[model samples]
Target: MSEDTTQDSAGFATRARIDTSRPHSARFWNYFIGGKDNYEVDRELGDRIKEIFPGLVDVAVTSRHFLGRAVRHLAGEQGIRQFLDIGTGLPTADNTHEVAQRVAPDARIVYVDNDPIVLTHANALLTSTPEGRTAYLDADLHDPEAVLRAAAGTLDLSRPVGLMILNTLGHVADHQQAQGLVRTLMAGLAPGSHLVICDGTATSEGMIAASEAYNASGAVPYYVRSVEEITGLFDGLELVEPGVVRVPEWRPEEADDAGSGAPVDAYCGVGRKA
Candidate 1:
């Protein structure tokens, strides 16, 4: 719930083709993160899940912090100047471009998302520094080839890119299929490209219950994997230090790591292709 939603939403309702009749994962997540882009149904389910398991709010909040740290590391330390951020949800403070450009002003970024609500808010995510470039693609992650083909217009595929797919793989029900999707995308990028992944894990009973409750709320089901499964997603890539641990523990800043040591039901890792 720590993400700052500073984007203006004037005339968003007229432009967006959203189905408010059902609960959506993106909107639900938006509600959890304290964004105003969600509908009443999303807030209702979010509130229900909050009562079922309040820790989920922390997962939403901390997962975003993990993103900022990861982007900073990639742009500053890894010297990665291009980023391909798939499954980009609603825009918030310190987005991929914002974080990357802060470290490297000329970092080029391409954000891909199929959600209509996200497309409606895409303008907010498109703002970039004069030295850098940012573009949005209304593409599905299921079609990695198409996603890459479209992204190539904005990003140079020959150079190393920071491929980010955070909190999004759970939508793919089958584990192998999800792995293949990642492989297909990574295969298209040049060597030295980093694979950044973070997703909910079946780490505790409460988290599992929360997942079930959310699925039963008529929202798109988001499956949580075990820590071993999460690690498997980064199979061929070289993992960074403290590999595949909880989100907040991955290269955390002093103040962010202070009291956030409690176990969160989400795990993340950054890996590089040789």
Candidate 2:
């Protein structure tokens, strides 16, 4: 085909893959977290969900804050220098690489996601410190071996890596399946590697209602689980102090606002591989 034809075909394929007709989880979460990379559909769903559970906004905001604190702890206190962040959503402020490289300039991070939109915005996530490296893999989380193989090109799997799943695993509807996926990913890493996870929990009626509404909107379903299920993701690993708890309560910083300490629907924890 001609160059112009090839370009047009590629553009068409990209547009086809991004279904703006319905809200997507990444874009909807981006809208919830005050980002500009979402469409009207995402905003509409986000606004509707807010009406169902105003606290859902807190879950989004506080979960983001939890990411910063978690990366800082891993890169600073734990002496980790590499990261494999799967299901990393749209690039926003204080992303995994930004937070990790800030604590340890030489930290290497590989971000994994299969969303075409996320891939388009991957350049924003590719910047790294001179001492560190950053790469984006167009890979899915269900296939642990493929993700690890691609990440190995950027990260050293033989060394301890900070595996971050964040709000992404909720896409897997089955609790056992999600737990098994986490175990498989962890099994591929070294002994000292740490698993950092946080997700929305079905701790309240409003949150549950919000989850049902969002899932009904034709977006990929995100199943919020009980705190017990959330903790179960770290079964083989040693739980960091404070164990699994509300995102903000895990390790609050002095700079956080008073509301940051309040309970939200999201829960998070860091666990070290033995």
Candidate 3:
């Protein structure tokens, strides 16, 4: 646990080197959520986006809360014990594994991300309780088979799993590609598996402007899609209670102030595979 390593008590360390000059999506999000794991360039881009759309920070916070609530519902009410969290950003509060394991001690989680920074913090993402297990996969969503194959090492595919795609689909700009990717991933899971999706929507002019600014920032361009397109991703699945609503409206916990408020430009839904 020195400057040379990010090793947890289990002697795991991040192998991906950090590049501070270029802005990264994971670090920028971590910054918005009030974490210190961001660089100056990331803050600069965030500040610029905030100036364009002040509500974006609200979207980030509320979207994260939606992930927590969705996971809680899947683990507690649905009795799901496995989770596949793709595009797992830097370890923050209420991560998929932490929240799932809190409800069911033996819950198993597999986190996949293509970002080097995210992989660099793999140690933090891999920390798990004795009763449960967690693992980080250095993989991409474009290849769903590879991801599922790698996830098998930690999770049981035969059982129901809560597949979480929170705020990550935007990174794939192509609409058809994104939908196909989701379909492929869901197809691999057994029947009764659940799908959780939360992504920024193109519902407001301010959000559109902010997205343009972010896309031009030299980082990966994230496309904010329409509500119909977002909901289309769950075509084959049965949506849960408050289906495909704003992130803040997705079954907020009593303590979740941001989630209980008015709608942001982000929408989310929890759907069960029939």
Candidate 4:
């Protein structure tokens, strides 16, 4: 279970220096979501963390559901056709392109991730409706400028774009830097663009224990911030209804048997850049 060295046939190339020895957060998340893009190290860490906080699995799955709902809302209700999804994890069910294209077949999306495993799974992400287009960009979250530049090749930056950053900000240990990154990325988009964010929070002892155990692992550390810190990410934007609540509580579809009020150890929201 080494790092994936496979090239993306979709024309995205990762910069050299991707270390396979250490588990990556994207791959670990892929493992949790029942995807085969992760290495043994990721699975081992994921399992260890799950043992400490079993609810993490629910958080991962529900965060994905939140992504679907948010994308659908933007594409369906808001009629947003372009999406710039930074920190795009491994390809999984109901990805941004899938949900957006389902709602509006002509939607275009650019997915940004630097993980080699995610690069290997980039083909699955390349799928798009005949009327729509999807592209993958191998870039780091820390380099939001490069991400926006590469994304501009696929998306029209002047138009409204849905910026999806699901469960990826925790990698930035510095809270101010993380907020700055979000603000920088949002600043590049047009007035009507939206920011969709969700991340694991330091809400409970079990979650804290899990974060500690994960940081102790060889993988890069991910810090769980307080709920207020999470909310601060959306400063200056108009929040959608039921703002910044638990992932499962966000405007869930009725068919989703998962109750809207159920508590999950993660928080999420969608904000419009007014």
RMSD of each: 5.5, 2.0, 3.4, 4.2
Global fold similarity of model 1 (TM-score): 0.93
Cα lDDT of model 1 by residue, 1-274, tens digit: 3234333353354355678898999889989888988889999999998898888988898888899999999999999999999999999878999999999999999999988888888999989999999999999999999999999999999999999999999999999999999999999999999999999999989899999998888888999999998999999999999899988889888656323446899999999999
Report the lDDT tens digits of candidate 2 across residue range 191-212. Answer: 9999999999999999999999
TM-score of predicted structure 3: 0.93
**lDDT, candidate 4, 81-192, per-residue tens:** 9998888887878889988998999999999988766776788999999999999988988988888889999899999999999888999999999999999999999999
After the best TM-score superposition of candidate 4, give how far the Cα of residue 266 lies from its true spot, in angstroms: 0.5
- The clash tally of candidate 1 reads 0
- The clash count for each model shown is 0, 0, 0, 0
Clash pairs of candidate 4?
A: none
lDDT at position 231, candidate 4:
98
The best candidate by TM-score is 2
Which residue runs does candidate 1 get wrong by more than 4 Å? 1-16, 257-261
**TM-score against native, each model:** 0.93, 0.95, 0.93, 0.90
| Colliding residue pairs in candidate 1 | none
The candidate that wins on lDDT is 2
The predicted structure with the larger TM-score, 1 or 4, is 1
